[model samples]
Target: IQHALSGLGYAAVKGVRQGKFFVLNLDGWGREEAQKQLERISKEVLTNPVIEEYRFEIVD
Candidate 1:
């Protein structure tokens, strides 16, 4: 993507990566529990740490 964009006059694009996004509605959970579950899910289920990275944000 970056290479193509740079060829197309986008000199400012240093790099480009594609990733997935998800929104999980945890019903009635507190911050601590949510954090724990999210961490476990991210490391164990959502991503392959060998090649992929993951991050999440919680919103009210």
Candidate 2:
């Protein structure tokens, strides 16, 4: 997951505990584009279908 985010240009800081959250400075892209890219990245790189399923909503 960290590698995937880095590949997308996010400067990710890995947590010492367990899970990681990426802090991204997404230039001037709108929320829709960000959400779309996140989904694509998660599916293609970060997640495994055999063990996980993802669902998301745009809050704004």
Candidate 3:
């Protein structure tokens, strides 16, 4: 990832990560509850719990 970015003339970039963007339609859940569930799902289902890291944003 870093190599590709560097080759594209982004010399200062030390790291590059390709992340997943998913639109999960939570029709009834509020923002707080949705965030909680997304966190849970992120840990338990979305990634490798032992090695990988992840982040989420609540988009309207």
Tens-digit lDDT track for model 1 on 1-60? 898999999999998989898789898789988988999998998889899989889787
Ranking by lDDT: 1, 3, 2
Over 1-60, each residue of candidate 3 has an lDDT whose tens digit, in order, gives: 799889999999997777766667777899999999999998998888788888888888
* Candidate whose lDDT is highest: 1
- What lDDT score belongs to each candidate, Candidate 1 first? 0.89, 0.66, 0.85
**Which candidate, 1 or 2, has the higher lDDT?**
1
| TM-score of every model versus the real structure | 0.85, 0.44, 0.65
Candidate number achieving the greatest TM-score relative to the actual structure? 1
Candidate 3 clashes between residue pairs 3 or more apart in a chain or in different chains: none
Q: After superposition, how far is residue 3 of candidate 3 from its true place, in Å?
A: 5.1
> RMSD in angstroms, all models?
1.2, 12.6, 2.6
Alpha carbon RMSD to native, model 1: 1.2
Tens-digit per-residue lDDT, 1-60, candidate 2: 677666778766553234434444566668989898878877787767577776555554
Clashes by residue pair, model 2:
none
